[model samples]
Target chain A: MIVAEQKPLDEIRDLIADAGKVLVVGCGTCVTVCFAGGEKEAGILATSLRMASKLNGNAQDVTHLTVQRQCEWEYLDPIEEQIRQAEVVVSLGCGVGVQALAEHFPQAWVVPGLNTSFMGLPTEQGVWEERCAACGSCILGLTGGICPIARCAKQLLNGPCGGSQDGVCEVNAETPCAWQLIYDRLKAHDRLDLLMEIQPPKDWSTSRDGGPRRITREDLRLVAEQVE
Target chain B: MSAADQVPLQIVAYCCHYCAYAAADLAGVLRLRYPGEPKIVELPCTGRLDVLEVLHAFEHGADGVMVAGCLEGDCHFQVGNLNARRRVAMVKDLLNQIGLEPERIEMFNMSSAMASQFAAAAEEMTARVRTLGPNPLREESVS
Candidate 1:
């Protein structure tokens, strides 16, 4: 899921400094689980902004609205009245959600309240580790379940670098060498022979196709004739 | 003396029902006299305390806030006091970001038998807030 963290309070304050009315919008999907930009966070941020504004002698009205998923237009459709009421809209969603709000409501000035960090999952209670680079390709079958593109510091495909020591990556001591883990797993499965088939430079054509990536399913799309 | 001390101060103390609440009750029973600035709001546990609740107190005119929970390792709910401590610390950081005194809010832990500690906490927070003056938000809204 997309993980994000709130921006600095001063930066957020500066973003909405000129506005007399501010609305905080939160996404209920990925950010809710990560405790970044959920309903509770939106409420806290709205309250904090109100208090901070008052303390600074800035008279401002701050309110909040949270949608089930900010990335979808239907989920955001119901809050049009709330969004229209504010001079500035602060989105506590991921980068996609922020852009969705901005795109959906052209009149409202939508500003991001969170710094969209990465696509990762929570490793523990409060720890999150990146797992997928979304490179639009799969190499897990060649390697082990561990992802070298996301887990490895250098994204080494062929084998571990010489700098690895004691199964730990030299790039980051905390990071276990992805290639080492792959080798160990393959050896356990008696498939260590796969490593000998040297992997050349990865095909990144699908990942970076010169522009923003998009996919359209002809089966799901309808034509003007069908709409008529 | 700071200009803050010249104005009236109101400090809200959110006390856990299991420990700090009972401690404050014991202080009252033991005829302990402390500053009356700290208004007590009882909760089931400090873990139940939310950042919005603390901010609500400040927005509604509180000059300072004190979250009183069970002792660090003695929380009846295991990590309730610890959670309350984290929330208190978070609120302090928020206050600092807002140009307010981070010392305006604090977290204290005590058992039911620690009446003296409860009174001392009250006196300490009262003095601290008095030195800091009335909440700037309150001053801003009033003007």
Candidate 2:
């Protein structure tokens, strides 16, 4: 899931300070699961903003709404009326959700209420840790299912870096050395011979270095000529 | 008249059914006297409490909020009280971040047999909130 944390209340207040009417939009997907931007959070934020503005003697009308998935256009269509009525929108979704809102409503001032942190899963309740960097490549099969790109401090492709000590990363003693984990797992599976293969350098172009990435599936695409 | 002279402080206490709620009942059975300002909302477990519920209490003019659950290591469901404590701490941080006093909300751990402790918690929280005065939102509602 895409994990995010709410921005400081003061910063959020500042963003909507000029608007007379504010709309707080929430995403029901990733941000909801992470407990950052969900229906409950949206309502609480709207209430807090209203109380804060009232205390400042500059009371503003704030509305709260949550879409099924803010990244999808159809889910956002239901809120078009509210978006049109609002002078400013504070999106409690991940970065993608905020951008989607902005793209769908160009005339409305849209701002992010959360700092989209990373693609990860909850390690435990109220705790989320990053797991994937979404590098547009999958190499888990070669590394005993442990992701070096996301877990290693240096994103090393092959063996453990020299900085590792006692199976712990030198960058942070608390972090388990990713390569050490791979080695231990491979040894248990009797596949230690796999480590002897010299792997080539990874292509960085598949990642963000190549600019914004898009995946087009011809099978799923709706051809413009089909409707006619 | 000053703001303090207006409405009495309104505090909400969410008590777990297995412990704190029964403790409150015991306090009443013993004829123990505690502040009457706090309105009790009984729950199956404090673990089920959400951060939004605490925030909404403040939003709806609650001068203070408290969550009373089973003592640490003695939850009826094993970890309900512990989970409640963590969430209460989170709510306190959120309250402080929004310019509200963190003291306005608190969590207490006590067993159903600790009737005196229940009354003490009520008195302690009531006095603390009285000193903190009414919630700022109360003033907004009044004017």
Candidate 3:
């Protein structure tokens, strides 16, 4: 799931400073699971903003709304009236949701209330760590399922670097060396020979380096065209 | 009468049913006197308390809010009290951030039989809130 953290209260207050009416929008999917831009968080943020504004003597009419998924058009359509009423829209969604809102309501000024952090999963209660870099490449088959792009301090394709100390990355003592984890897992599976195979440099075209990525399904597109 | 004298400080206490709530009831049976300004809201567990609820209390005129739960490791629902304690700390930090006194909110722990402790907590919270004066929002509403 996509993980995010809310921007500081003061920063959020400043973003919607000039607006008389503000709408705080929350996404119910990825950001909800990570406890960032969920319905509950949206309400708390709205209340906090109101209190902060009141204290600053620039009281604002803050409204709170949560959609199932802000990235989709249909889900956002229901709150069109509220969005129209608000002078500024504060999106408590991930980066994609913020963009979706902006695209859907070009007339309305949309601002992000959260700093979209990473694509990851909760390791434990209240703890989330990045797992997939979404490099548009699949190399997990050769490396025991651990992602070097996301986990390793240096995205080493082959083996542990000289900076790996006692299975910990030298960049930060708290971080476990990704290559070491791959090595241990491969040894347990009796596939240590996989590490001996030298991996070539990863192709950058599939990643963000090329440009904004797009996935087009020709079959789905053709079906939609026929229906139209 | 001044504003403070005219409106008694409003304190909201969210008590867990198994322990803190029972302790308050026991205190009443024992005829122990505590501040009457606090209105008790009983909950299955303090873990059910959300940050919004505490903020709402203050937003709606609560000068102080207290969350009382089972002592550590003695929660009827295992870690409910522990989670509530962490949430209380978070709310306190938020209160401070918003320019409100952190003392306006607190968390306390007690067993079901601790009637004296419950009364003491009530007295302690009431005194703290009284010293802090009414919630600034109340002043805003009055003027």
Ranking by TM-score: 3, 1, 2
Cα lDDT tens digits, model 2, A25-90, are: 999999999989999999889987887787688889998999999999999998999999999999
**For all the models shown, what interface RMSD does each have?**
1.1, 1.7, 0.9
**Each prediction's fraction of true contacts recovered:** 0.88, 0.44, 0.60
Most DockQ-accurate candidate: 1
Name the runs in model 1 displaced over 4 angstroms: A224-228, B1-7, B139-143
lDDT of 3 by residue, B1-143 (tens): 65655567789999999999999999999999998978999999998988998998887779999999999999999999999999999998878767789999999999999999999999999988888888877644433
| i-RMS of candidate 1 | 1.1
Q: Per-residue lDDT of A1-228 in model 3, one digit per residue for the tens?
A: 999999988889889999999999999999999999999999999998888777778889998989999999999999999999999999999999999999999899999999999999888989999999999998999988999988988888988899999999999998999999999999999999998889999997899897999999786775545563
Better of 1 and 2 by DockQ: 1
Q: Write the per-residue lDDT of candidate 2 for residues B1-143, one digit (tens) a residue.
A: 76764657788999999989999999999999998988999999999888887887887789999899998998888898888998888888878766788999999989999999999999999989878888987645443
Expressed as tens digits, the lDDT of each residue in A1-228 for candidate 1 is 998999998899999999999999999999999999999999989988998888777778999989999999999889999999999999999999999999999999999999998889998999988888888888999996878999888888999889889999997898788889999999999999999998989888767654579999887878655653
TM-score, every prediction: 0.94, 0.92, 0.95
- Listed per model in order, the count of residue pairs whose N, CA or C atoms clash below 3 Å is 1, 0, 0
Error of 3 at A141 (Å): 1.2
Candidate of highest lDDT: 3
Identify the candidate with maximal TM-score. Answer: 3
Stretches of candidate 3 off by over 4 Å are: A222-228, B1-6, B139-143
